[model samples]
Target: MSDNDNRGDKPQGPDNGGNGGGGSNPWMKSLLIWVGILLALAIFVTMFDGRAATTGGNTIAYSAFLDKVDEGTVKDVNISRDMISGTLSSGEKFKAYPIPDSTLVPKLRDKGVAISAKPEEGPSMLMLLLYQSLPFLLFLGIAFFVLKQMQKNSGSGAMGFGKSRAKMLTQKEGKVTFADVAGIDEAREELEEIVEFLKDPTKFARLGGKIPKGALLVGSPGTGKTLLARAIAGEAGVPFFTISGSDFVEMFVGVGASRVRDMFEQAKKSAPCIVFIDEIDAVGRHRGAGLGNGNDEREQTLNQLLVEMDGFEANEGIIIIAATNRPDVLDPALLRPGRFDRQVVVPRPDIEGRIKILEVHMKKVPLAPDVDARVIARGTPGFSGADLANLVNEAALTGARKGKRLVAMAEFEEAKDKVMMGAERRSMVMTDDEKRMTAYHEAGHAVVAMHEHASDPIHKATIIPRGRALGMVMRLPERDSYSYHRDKMYANLAVSMGGRVAEEVIFGYDKVSSGASGDIQYATGLARDMVTRWGMSDKVGPLEYGEPEGESFLGYSSSRPSRMSNATAQLIDDEIKRIVEGGLDRAKQVLSEHIDQLHTVAGALLEYETLTGDEIKKLIAGEDMDRPVPGAKVSSVPKAGTSIPKTRRPNGPFGSPTPLGA
Candidate 1:
């Protein structure tokens, strides 16, 4: 840290006055242009006043001059090209315009007034030059200013086009440390080596091992990739240079390449620094995807980045950390072994990670005694670090809106509902028939979930409208699973189709509403994945027919044309349909067998508008109880105390463990 104290004032880029490409500051240059315009205007006004001669004369009309001559009172006269000036008998200097007449001068002579014709006094040579060139000068000045500004804003300005746009955060400024970043402990551990290398390169170099030139962070969005890089900088106590991928490219060609070179040059001077490029896929897409026939600007930029990462000369003391969600689209050259030596994957947080993330985010907010981070985390599956942070903020906001001083578990539940299903549409008015229909639909989903052991546990079932849905049934897993088995997949499909089955069974097939549109779509997709991706179709055998939409290098998908014939394609479709239909039949059977239970649950829903999972379970178990009034709040659902058993898929990751079946 002490070593970096003096380097804090080091030059950054053109924006910070570090000389690289151009000298004139674009903003200052614009100011000078405007100042020139104001000066030109002031000079024009002075010249106009000089011509008026307002201080030297009392103005008189031409007829007055003639009248004075007729009275023989005019003493002297002076005539110019279009004006007449004379001294009257009263000794006042008068100015007037002369009329074109031959008799005028003769009358002046008969009056015995001294008359003389004076040559017009022309403007001086300097003023004359200014008069001729003022418009051109103003135009040139304005044009120059405009061109510079366009270049500046367009990212192709002569002065700054090649200069790096990276903003440096000094040791003191970069206050983020490993302590602030929660979740993804494995990624943090992997990056710890980078911190060690930056702190003392000799420790690794002496052992004949060169430090890695770069590390690429691959993850879904909002997974704390950038935050990890900042933590590395804070841990190593070095300067951090940050920039976005889009900042490198410009409308003008070759500018992006030049910026890459300038950025590396800056990083070299400030050695032992971290250069973080967020969303690197923007500039590092596969080459030869040309716009028309030739190489595009982005390709050239990526080429330069490739060379800079592992050029002929060593890039000692500089570590590049790039984050991208679309690693599949990145060029092979940029991700080669020598270029980006390490690839760290930052996936969504599991249950444990989610709890840690919640703890980190909740440090600043005041919470009630019953606010448990573990319960909230268990309820939030597939949540990234950013999402968890947002959940905490939203819960605080919900409490504030209710005039509460401290956030309670109730607010957390409300916040989770808002984040997952969208805000409640309390203002939406519905008829009694619509309410009853929604209640039945939700009860169908809840009952189906309870009957299917492989399916997740029901968290809540409500007829109240949320987001775009008329009703919602939330299913949350007690613990994390990395993969899904066929049983679970089938159960999930059955649960998704339960609403449509219930509607068809109760209201008749033709009378069923379109509220199950989303459910059908989800169920269909699940069935398709089972056939094409999971190889669960007996006719299709153990072969995958679907071509993923991106490369699978880091578990990302890329698309390819299908090689199967029309007959095989037809078989795949048939298998998908068979799976979906089987699930539908199962859901219908479960609902038909327990029609009485469905009626009871739906009745409770109509009475309360909402029902907790425990309450639904009790009602389905044939328990009789006093129901609350229509507007009374229902008791909070019990927290899940332990994780459920997880089963692994045939050829998938450990398990597909997501909170609440997101």
Candidate 2:
């Protein structure tokens, strides 16, 4: 609960690598400069065109010009057929047009005004051409600007296709220090040295220590790998360049490679900065593993990245930090020492880490006194930092929906259910018979699980439809368990079979619905793992039979065919079935022995729709619950589900997946 709160930490650079997050781009400045130059050139041309511009000489009436010529007051005269111009006796310049002008030249000749027969000096050919083409030049400039603007808008403007999309984050944007990060403290400690080195390199240099070149953050999704990198940058007060690995791959050949070079160029200018490539597996895959041709765009991008990291010329003070969930797919060369000098495993947070993470997130919320972070952490086994953050957000949102001043424990419980189990689906209509069957199914699970000493305790049981389940029983582990015990696995299998067992006992074999599809699928998978992988089956000794991932990208080997002979494969299958049937039989036996308790639990579910673990115990003991009776749901009229998937855990393994029977 005392974990330092970084609720305010929202660090918001690269290569002054200033083209960062919201920083100014050099290309944009260049574009503006070109526009200004074109404008200045157009103005210059308009000012200098001799023939198209006025001479700025004074004008006089034609009759006055005649009077001047007659008086011989004009010292000199220059005349064309249409007009006359001369310096008067007083040496002032003047110009006049001839009226009914065939005699204009003759009059000028009579006056002896030194008139030239050549038409008053017309503009040069070069000037005429320039003046004529000015409009077209302006049109082309405008077209060029529009084209550049369109390209810029699409992020592929003139010369923009090859520019790096890496955003630079600076301290001024928002400072996110190590304090902002919670959970995965080991990974934080590993990265802290880098920040120290960046802040004062001489501290390490004096001791003959060279700054580590790179660090690879390997973890599952939502484990806070990217967040840690930003925290390092914030702590060190250095430029942070962030770009997704996918941003490097472009449809156009050479574009990706060009971007890699450009990104490094920007990073070099902002030396001692960190360049973080997120989801690096997108571009940093094994080069030849599944690549169609030797010279594809992604491969080229990867190759260029390799050169930039450790090429002929050294890149000083530039640190490379990359993140990926699938480190197995990354190229080996990229992982060599001096490149990614360290591989920091940012695994899912443990129970203690989760509590700290909860504390950090809770600081932003108005939490009720009853909101114990420890309780929430206990229920959320296998949750990552991102999951805990999301849990807090969901709880706050739930509280706001209820117009509560503070987020309470009830809201956190509901948010957890929504996060792990699918959200409540009360609108999915069910016939009374379906409802009764679901009640019996969930009751069987709760009863059978209660009988298993090794099984995790039931947290909640609901007959109301949720996610894809018509009903479900959720189990909360006493503590976070990394590896499952053999007994626990068996208990899980029995609990999984409980729903089907209950339906068969009450409704008979012919009346059983397909509601057990997800359970059966989960059971079969678990049993197979137990037999083939865990070596739980005595018949099949401990040996990995087949690879879970046999499919690979670009012909790469991510899988191996089962090495066991046909007969051996058949034996493995038999063991799996045997394990499953054993669990099912155990479930049947437990449900039969506790038949009365199962009925009581089911009746309570029908009455209340949902019950906590203690409530179930109380009802079985013939005690009334203190809570109010469940009311009808607001959206209970029945709506066809659009979110519920065929599988119980549709969102997959990122967050706390809907546990078996949950």
For residues 101-202, what per-residue lDDT tens digits would candidate 1 score against the true structure? 899877888889898987767889998898888879888978887896677555556677688787775543436789987889999988998888777888
Q: Cα-based RMSD of the predictions, in order?
A: 10.2, 10.1
Clashing pairs in 2: 13-168, 13-169, 14-17, 14-168, 15-266, 20-168, 21-168, 151-157, 272-317, 290-554
Q: Where in model 1 is the C-alpha error above 4 Å?
A: 1-33, 63-93, 100-119, 149-154, 158-177, 230-239, 246-259, 286-301, 359-371, 396-411, 426-431, 509-514, 535-582, 622-626, 629-662
TM-score of 2: 0.75
Q: Give me the overall lDDT of model 1.
A: 0.77
How close is every model to the real structure, measured as TM-score?
Answer: 0.77, 0.75
lDDT of each residue in 1-662, candidate 2, tens digit only: 00000111111112122344333676677678788867867776666763434544688888888787788887777655665667887878888776676765676667777765445566789867877787787778778867976775556776687988888765665567799888888999999988888989999999999998899999888888878877876787887888889998988888999999999999999887889898899998887776367688989999999999988989999999999889887899999998999999998888899999899889999989999999999888888888888889999999999999999999999999888776888788888878878887887888887888898888888887766677888888888677888888888888888888777767665677788887788888888888778777788888877565523654555333446687888898898887887777777667656776777777778777788888877766657778653322212221212111122223642132222322
- Report the poorest 10 consecutive residues by lDDT, candidate 2: 1-10
Error of 1 at 107 (Å): 7.0
* Most TM-score-accurate candidate: 1
Tally clashing residue pairs in candidate 1.
17
